[model samples]
Target chain A: MPFTAPPLFPGDLFEGAARLAASAEGRLSAVSEAPARAAVLDALWEEAAALGWPAVMVPEAQEGAGGTLEDLVAILDGAGRAALPLPLAAACGVVPAMLPAEAGGVVLPFVASGEWRVAPAFAELMRDPRSPAAAAATEGGVLRLSGSVIGMEAPPGATHTLLHAPVDGASGLILLPLDEGGPGLRRFERLDGRPSLDVLLDGVTLPGTALLARGEAVARAAASARALGTLLVMVEAVAAMGALVGQTIEYLSTRVQFGETLSRFQVLRHGTVDLYTRHEAARALVVSLVTAAAETSVAELDARTLHLAKLHVGRAAREVAEGAIQLHGGMGLTDELPASRLTKRLLCVEFDYGDGAVHAALAA
Target chain B: MDAAGTDYAAFRAEVREFCLTRCPADIRALVARGGKLGRDAWSRWQRILFDHGWGAPNWPREYGGTGWDLRQRHIFDETLAESDCPPQYHHGLRHLGPVLIEYGTEEQKRRFLPGILDGSVWWCQGYSEPGAGSDLASLKTRAVREGDKYVVDGQKTWTSHAQEADMMYTLVRTSQEAKKQQGITLLLIPLDSPGISIRPIRTIDNWQHVNEVFLDGVRVPAENRVGEEGQGWSYGKFLLHHERLAGANVAPLLRQLARTRRLIEEGATEGEEGRRRALEHRLLLAEAEITGVRALGHAALEATLRREPLGNTAAVIKLTSANLMQRLDEIALDATGHRLVSRFRPVDGNAPPEGMEWLQNYLYGRVRTIYGGSDEVQKNLLARTLFGH
Candidate 1:
């Protein structure tokens, strides 16, 4: 008998993604800089819109396309395979559920070591403690906004910032109009050439409704949401690792050293085996978690499962990513190659919610 | 599928009921205490199944077995595993019995098969020697032909249950000049024969399951050789195939996991959500993998019953099952915390609960993938079967 498993998803999601990934191969190869990358991201957004990705999670009654969690996983798996650079995971996972619909595609900045940073572009900035972007409270009917959020980014068509804050003695999400925010908002050019900004919210008066409730309920829900997004990031990292490893294996098969293909060397074969093993381990764990989330209804339990998946996948991702680079010789580190891009993205994903150390301590 | 078409369901229910009654209360208590049965208990348990004629369900009826089909065999294995019953002496039921049935003379079969069925003669395998383990075909245990006997000399290491065994079935080199695969012969040697000695090798887990058996001019009658002279290589290979099939038992793992789930549920507090969920997730994944293995095993057994070639797919089952066993033990240790560190005590009231079995199983499981042909060897077999040499 063939080694068959239960269908991971109900319908054509996996198949669709696989096709898209195959078709976009040339497009992905042509893209080099952030401007071209942003255009590719726009094209991806259009494709996602065509697939109704944004509406997959929304309830059918709430204008959603009536897709399940499995559907979302399939779509993300596809995105990973295609090496697409859209923030679909964050948008679908974090924004619609955690923040209000008006927030409009929030770039969820991750907080690590008391520093706030946006991923895919890890630019660090100092918090302006005097601005509404640093708002910590909303008393009575007035919104007492203070402090600044560093590492804010305004991509090509992004209209607003779905900023995160420690509000009223609790961490909450807020929608900040980037264009309306004063000189407090300073734009910084990133190494990856993406447009990022530092928003200062000093003594800004705002309506109570502007404050998204940072209650325990919201925090719990948001954390769970963030976990789902992190899971996709992990899936993407695995896919990229797969591609790089495949390419390296192909190169080694053709490249001769000492009168034989590099692949013929026992040492290289063993190293490749190690890489494959770690990659499979990560894939197994991630797929298992995705299946778990689909089959269960317990939110807290799902959150925990996602956390463990992140920890395992993060650690494996780093190893596989680095292994891919090492195997590719000096070409792996240069910007001219895709391996470096994968490495950078994987590094950012590793610290997105928490690193291996943070999650491991929590899990333990 | 109709209810009757699914014969496994009915067989599973029947085996479950049998285990609930025939499995000794003490054995259940031991399992409850996270202990596996010792040799003595296992013998009694085997006899219980023998009395019910359920012993050796995988063997043919002519050889004192149930003669069940593949699905039934799977049901029996699944039930046995889930019940946490004492492990039957596999050396007899899984290894020697099948080998003898296929290759033993009628007189040999009549004498040994019944004893194996009744648990009267405990069996141990003497395949691995001090000098030959992974390179098993290169065994140097010499068996020189005498007038009416073969003089066996050399040592066998890692002989399971050798201390308690009444007889041992061994592979010995019969001719030095013949190719490694050509000059070997299989001999059934009595453990109590003069010049045969056994010394226990205490492993890191402090268990006595393994032993080193030395044969200094031990002599066995000519009738003890199962097949033709210098044909032991083929017979040993056949025996290994059967052994691999028997080793792919996933039921015990399921039972252990069920126990782990209970322990986690009972011990962990409501606030320990992360640990609880992680354990639960692992349990589910294990269940899925075990189910997959069961399906694969059932398919292999069915092919065998139909007189079709199993090829090297048997190795696949063995490989997957060994991996699952290792994973289950790891999860068990993780679930029990420091309890795993304690030594194992006997199931009897006078002896403290022997917690050592879990540790022993963990250590033993590490060698499982390496033994019975390393996983790499199995994969190579698979690759050859798929792509050819």
Candidate 2:
């Protein structure tokens, strides 16, 4: 009856990640609050990298673990459950999946080794491939990139960015250093108090080696990255929402009014039940999306299903979080309760990538 | 596991074929057209399921039930619901049958069980009185012991299908000396008794599905009492649990959503903006349906493997499905931007106009949350059980 659901797609590696996240729960709260410094981020990344999470979706031959999609998903679920407060979502979801196998020999070790923290770009580009936000032109055999993605802001302690641009009349991936932004990178605060960046690759130069994959391969990697991103975030969402609702249920049971506990009120009980079902459904939908795709390579993951699942998970998370707030009444919005944190996290998740409305159109 | 899980794939295929092939075409047509079918048609459909021993998939097999576990029952229900099969009439089949199987005496079972199985006798509930509903322990419908018979004199309101029923399962106050709930006794009263009268109460949907039953000095032998005296409250709650099982998923909402999507695709909206709105709401309903399916899967696991009794789950489903069902209809109306026409006639046609149906469905679906267990009552019960206040 408690809100936690059985892990729908768990593996031995996922179990290890879940345990690691559990052990590091209190320690990672800072990652979500502020962008970790180079040393702090490195230490955090090394701890996770030591467990080989970054290499989960990469091939083992490329100095990676060659883990299944479920490994990445479970790790994200654990991180989100602990509210690890890091770019772990991007680290596990976008970075490894987006870096194509073709680029693994040159760049894979750094990425797989957690030496690079590549902030994702081209969220807007993915939606409108015809007019990508970033454009590229080659000069002296070096690619110069210029284009700005919406919803990007420079992080306080950023290193690398997985920038997507138009290369050779097709979408291509490039690893650009964040500090050399040339004034195109704008930084802003995300809902969860994390720093986000928007970058204009104007006059930004990438060596020919920075061209990871072009044509179908780049597009495929980008799509895979986005799909995996949604799925992993959803795993985190399920936990956060579950914890929030559980706290709400606990509050309703003890918080007394009318000489009776709120839990004794059928209205509140049924409302929590409603939230419970939503959490359960989101878990089932997301687990299916991740586990099924794990059977195939990341590039083959279905985007439409991922979009539909995200749409559902995002809405369900909001409902559970908001309903928890509403039922908690006065204590809901207060920082004393985790409901405050969950509400903020839910808002962030909803707007991340394409929201329900955007996914709806794409699904259509 | 999902619907595509290997364990249930074949079972789903079997149920799907049975529903598609065996369900009556007229009933299917009535359902697909968003119209009501005749009672005889409903009974005929039930008879087919009865013949297959699937009339009550959750019941034990020895008493004409299918003896399927939770997942199998879910597959059967989902298949039938999606096939546009007329919903099974539940007055005698789902509620009272389960109660009787669980608590009825051997002689009582012999007398009543077969009738329910054969789909012959129709029964209606007689729990809600003029004063007692959500707080049902306070019911005042009284019965006085007279030798070997109990003389009953009271009224039951919101008696669904009372006009068509041959018998009524009632809760009457037998003793008022101790507690409100402890003094209650359940009696199976014949609706055809000399002093019994049934009056129709039309709902907001202009449907006469529910009624008021007036009992004046109706006499029933002591044997007609279900189980022991002073246990009616317990039996009623059990019956309600059975009734609420249907709430687990709004699978039927999927059809309404599909129809709405088709309406949008067929140019139900006027402008580009309106079309976009229609598409957005349609997809929202789709997301809600996926959520419902996921909940259904988890509920099945809990009920089957964990042997968790259907307490919070039924209420959760009821509350959630009611809210979603209402939302689904609004989405349909949003697509068509239709108002209920004054002269809409759903009965005369194979398929009513989409706008009219959407409007009617929207209006009628308004009461789904209020009936069965009212949303408020369900919430209170779920709160108490889930958190143990």
Residue-wise C-alpha lDDT for candidate 2, range A264-309, written one tens digit per residue? 8766788889988988788778767666776775457676777788
- Listed for each candidate, the true contacts retained, as a fraction, are 0.00, 0.01
Which tens-of-lDDT digit does each residue in A153-258 have in candidate 1?
Answer: 3443444555556677676666555445532544432222234445556766666765655667656656555666666667666665565566667756765543
What DockQ, between 0 and 1, does each candidate earn?
0.01, 0.01
Number of residue pairs clashing in candidate 2, backbone atoms closer than 3 angstroms, sequence gap of 3 or more or interchain: 16
> Which portions of model 2 show Cα errors greater than 4 Å?
A1-364, B1-7, B241-245, B267-276, B285-293, B296-303, B308-311, B336-355, B385-388
Residue-wise C-alpha lDDT for candidate 2, range B240-289, written one tens digit per residue: 65655565545676776676666666653332454457567566756666
Candidate 2 chain A weakest lDDT stretch, 10 residues: A123-132
Q: Best TM-score goes to which candidate? A: 1
